[model samples]
Target: MIPDADPSADQAPALAEQAPLTERGARTRARILAAAREVFEERGYPETRVAHITRHARVAYGSFYTYFPSKEAVFLEVADLLFQTMIQLDLVPSDGYEPATLIRRANRAYYASYRRNAKMMAIIEQVATFNVAFQEMRRKHRAGAVARSAKAIERWQRAGLVDTALDAEMAARALAAMVDHSLYLWFVQGDDVPDTERLLDTLDTLTLRALGLRP
Candidate 1:
């Protein structure tokens, strides 16, 4: 004979009440998030509203509140998702690659990711200008990349692959800024696209020269 199951034992914690949303509920939440992304990309943060997102999502007016608390909440979620996607980009080169080749590969990966998310990136930048929270988010994202690059630079310096006098953190920040602003200008600011091969080559050469990897 089987013993009776304990209802209390199966009960989830109060804090995680929403953790087990049903498949249908999950789909609705995803729809709302996708709609929020679309509205933010098209109308921007200032111009977008919960109504707009709900309409685009095709859910009942009340259904939105069931998942998100407010417009800012949903927008932040969308921004977080975009940043997570970007952070997953394959920027690290494999071992045994030359420094120039590694830099080139990293640049190409960043540019490709930026191109794919250009519109959302523009929206995130715009929001970051006036939103303290978003500004912090952007700063943290950049800091993570900079920290990784600095460590890589330090390793190169230890190996006598780059200039020992170069400050790793500062150099990483500067190189990251260079790549970011270059992509921003070309993709966000509507600058004419330069020859991709030439652009990558120039950037690679400049990076290598800066690191004293090449004369």
Candidate 2:
């Protein structure tokens, strides 16, 4: 005995779900973030403004604020995205591989990512000066990367691939930190050196040896 619902009302929800980002909410938020990365990279966070992001996004100013409260929020998202991407890439190594093989696979994945986004890598150099908020966000982002490495090491320990003498978590943190800092320095340093692929390969072998893994 229930009345038939209005057809037009039923159609509205479907249309809303299919609308373009300019007309939808979450899609608009993604657009803002996409624009924010380019703007932040080009001008740095302090010099960049909301107008820049909105203009780059081709969205309204109101839309920008609807998604992010300030430029800081957008910058944090950028850092978070970078960290997430790194973890996603590193974890692609399969569970069946030995710890050394997994470590090498993860290293290759990380360097491939860096090569793909060299510009964003450059932008990171400038972001540290912005404020404590940015600094804290960057730290959290790095900790996530370190955690990924730690997980792989723990897996190795569980599999009996590495010595039980060294603390896996500590070793992982040190190794991850070393790789991150070394890659950054290699990119920014002024001396002529081996290409990224070669450098990463060398590091992979060296890291395995240092971790007491055999050939």
Candidate 3:
């Protein structure tokens, strides 16, 4: 869950309910969240310190606790903000397009959103490796995406667009896995990220081919 690497630029709204933030307090909290994102991205979660956050935010060290309970709390807020932004992208292509066209368009949108948040996503994967709750959250997130794709596949199958023999749920899960892992490899792990056109075209080709659409 990450993008707009300098979150301060957007000034993400505070998470969870609390007494309304005074204008000054709101600004300070936003600063801390922005700074925390920077520090966490720079140092990774394990290496990040409250002190680092305070210094970068330029807030008094003790004031960190006034806004957040702990490093984990602040991290969660920052992560949740990115997650919200990332999911705001509706991957389900709207009506009127052919199924194959919808798939390509959806994949392109997914790639763009993922690319914007790639830096935060790498850290999310790292944290999920050991954090059970976070791991489960990741699973749930993927499951939701897979479920959406499965429904789309089922619709396409009914229209005689997709191969009927294919199990919609299983096929969707495979396709979702393909897209997710490939993005991680291309954007997060690989040194040479492909040009925008190549990146979208490659995934579009592979996904469309896998769905038994024209190559």
The stretch of ten residues in a row with the least summed lDDT in candidate 2 is 1-10
Tens digit of per-residue lDDT, candidate 3, span 128-160: 778775665556556655665677777777888
* Tens-digit lDDT string for candidate 1 (99-154): 66667767787778888999998988888888886677667766766766787788
TM-score, structure 1 vs. true: 0.85
TM-scores of the candidates in the order shown: 0.85, 0.78, 0.79
Q: If candidate 3 were superposed on the true structure by all CA atoms, what would the RMSD be?
A: 6.1
lDDT of 2 by residue, 74-135 (tens): 77777667755645553432535555565666677777776666567767767776567667
- Which regions of candidate 3 are displaced past 4 Å? 1-20, 90-93, 191-196
| Residue 135 miss distance in model 2 (angstroms) | 2.8
Higher-scoring candidate on TM-score, 1 or 3: 1
Models ranked on TM-score: 1, 3, 2
Candidates 1 and 3 compared by lDDT, better number: 1
* Candidate 2 C-alpha RMSD relative to the actual structure: 11.9
Highest-scoring model, TM-score: 1
Which candidate's lDDT is highest? 1
Regions more than 4 Å wrong, model 2 = 1-23, 90-93, 188-191
